[model samples]
Target: MRDDGRAILTPPARGIAHILPRDHPQRLVLNDEVHARPSEILEAPLKLSYLAVFAEGEQRADVWRRVQELAGRYGVDPAPDTANHYSANFGPFRIKCERHTEFLRLVFIVEDGRQPESFEEPALQAVPPEWLAALPGQLITAANVLLQHSDGDWPEPERIATQFFDGNALVGASIADGAAFAFTDFRIRADGFSRLLVMDHGMTPRQAGRTVQRLLEIDTYRILALLALPMAHVLAPFLAARERELAEVTRLLVEAKAPDEALLFDRLTRLEAEMESEQSRNHYRFSASVAYEALVDSRITELREERLAGLQTFREFLERRFLPAMETCRSSAASQESLSQRLTRVTQLLSTRVDITREAQTQDVLASMDRRAKLQLRLQETVEGLSIAAITYYIVGLVGYLAKGGSRAGLPIEVDLVMAASIPFVLVLTALALRHHRRKAARES
Candidate 1:
């Protein structure tokens, strides 16, 4: 405050937010990501129906539009297209939906005062049958969770197992430090839904919600991880055939002659093409399997499960059943990489062999040409010598005629002697003239 008794205002302290520019395009999204798909705070004696659908990319819009339609039915504003997750309450039930990279999961929850008389009547009964039937995509996962807080006289695990899981051996665990007990047969029932019974012993609503969410994720990812198994199985036999073919190709490569090399190269090319096709088709599924498997492990660890007396924990069950399937997938992927590398090496080797053969053929052709050129040069020299001799002979004959005419006119000496005398001189002059012409021509060239 100033001495004049007027209230004095201090300037606001500087903040980084004030200094920084407006948010980047994804700033808000990245900030909101951690809060996405938060677990619902679930109360006891609730029935939850969950479904996971695997769909093509084009079909996803239809699913989202359907979600908007459902929201309209409930008189709630629809989720925007950019939203990857949403939840809202209708009068009879609450719905939560999440969009994933390859699948869409929708969960319906119904609050109730008491447990349902029979587990068969799930919360999905409240959802419109038409909507359920018209859900766009193949149903990959479906489960019904009956969550109830335990009362006095806790039911035996075997009783709860037989009652809820249709007499299958129960895999039970006390999770979250015995705050809850979970039971499941891990078997799909006739109604195409697996059952989970969560006896919430003393967990808060949030803890129970998280527990149930984890259970559902564990199941969903378990199925997703196992999806790679069948693909691996199919590829296994194909890979074996490729291996055999590659072996034969390698053997032929070692001993193949010029004529056979081309055919062998063609075979190798076709084999590599087929292997690449398989890899392209199955690569995503295999990689997704590994990712989903890891997610399952993470969720199980978060469960912090303590073994139930006389029953296997979730991790143990996975080690015995799920791990083997995942390992098969890993092994298949490894085999593909190994085979691809071997094929590449063999291809390089074959290319080198072809190049070397072509080089040898070119060298032979060059050597043959050199030999032919030398022979042609010798023939040309012989022709030139014969031509020179002919010219010299004609010149000497002309000199002889001149000498004869001179002698006939009684000029000097005998014609034959004079002609013989001029023979050597004519030959010498002709040879000198030819040599001079050759030198001039060579200089001009």
Candidate 2:
């Protein structure tokens, strides 16, 4: 026994083994010895699930009836509907059914229960002999039927169909594809011991159920990514086109072209509104992730790169081709409007432009004159200070000479008093002359 209390065995069949004590809540044990020799151990306890594929539009009733007959022979049930359509025992077996536009799927599971405490027990001795002999034939029969059904002539596109059966119930899958339809089938033995086959199909209710939880997880992410592509590619282009049209209309308005302006504006607004509504609807959102994953696969990566390159090319085309076209349209519209408008209106527009230019020139002239006046005032102040200094110097020298001569001739006058009196008079005359010079310079400049 393994540490987990499950009995392990390498049976007579190569690569096939039996795992007992399979009822544990935390672990699933498989019969691996049978897996090694797939052909010799057909009746071994199935450790893995099987998948069957069918072409789409194959008569649903016929397919169900055939499967029903097979299930009845094996003492299993055929659960049929628009969604799930296969059944298996809840004890130690797995079964599943799914349908797509071009294919159908059927899978089977086998369970090996916990080992008996002693091999001497009658139940323990009888268990292996009873189950193993019957299992292989049943699996083979079911697979053959599904294969035959797939081979039948049908109007749908030709497809390849295959099924997988594992000696151990842990891993198996099936695939079906036709020209118009494709789908995959998978089976898992739960880690927690349970006797249920999780059947999943592309219906809303199945998506919410436990059986399909993992498949749904993968599909959902892919769908989201795929949905974003059209937004960037298809819808973006439409929006850009509308934007260009609006830009043209605005350019025309700026040029005072009124003809058809209201109509163009109305059309552009309506297009924008339609684009918004389509975006809100987002019909492709669910499938986007799947598309993106499909692109990510090794075989499709080049195609995805090409699609992205195409998108870039389309963007360039819109900028280079459509934008220039819109500009031309605006130019033509403006020319036409100029011809249609009354002469008085055209003349008024021209007159408005001329008036604006003239007003700007007048402001420039007034500013220039103000600057020149300020400069003249500053020059006059500077010249007045220089003139005062020069006049004072001359007057002081004259007073000094007179004082010296008067002193020598015995005149009753102090040199300092004479110089002080002359200073004020000299300053006053200098100020007057500086003011007159500034006036003259201002008039000339």
How many steric overlaps are in each model, in order?
0, 32
The CA lDDT of each predicted structure is: 0.88, 0.40
Compute the lDDT for candidate 1: 0.88
Model 2 misplacement above 4 A:
1-75, 80-86, 89-93, 98-216, 219-232, 250-258, 273-281, 284-445
Residue 397, candidate 2: how far off, in angstroms?
99
Superposed Cα deviation of residue 402, candidate 1 (Å): 8.4
Residue 129, candidate 1: alpha-carbon lDDT? 92
Taking every candidate in turn, the Cα RMSD to the unseen true structure, in Å, is 4.0, 22.2
lDDT of 1 by residue, 192-213 (tens): 9988888888999999989999
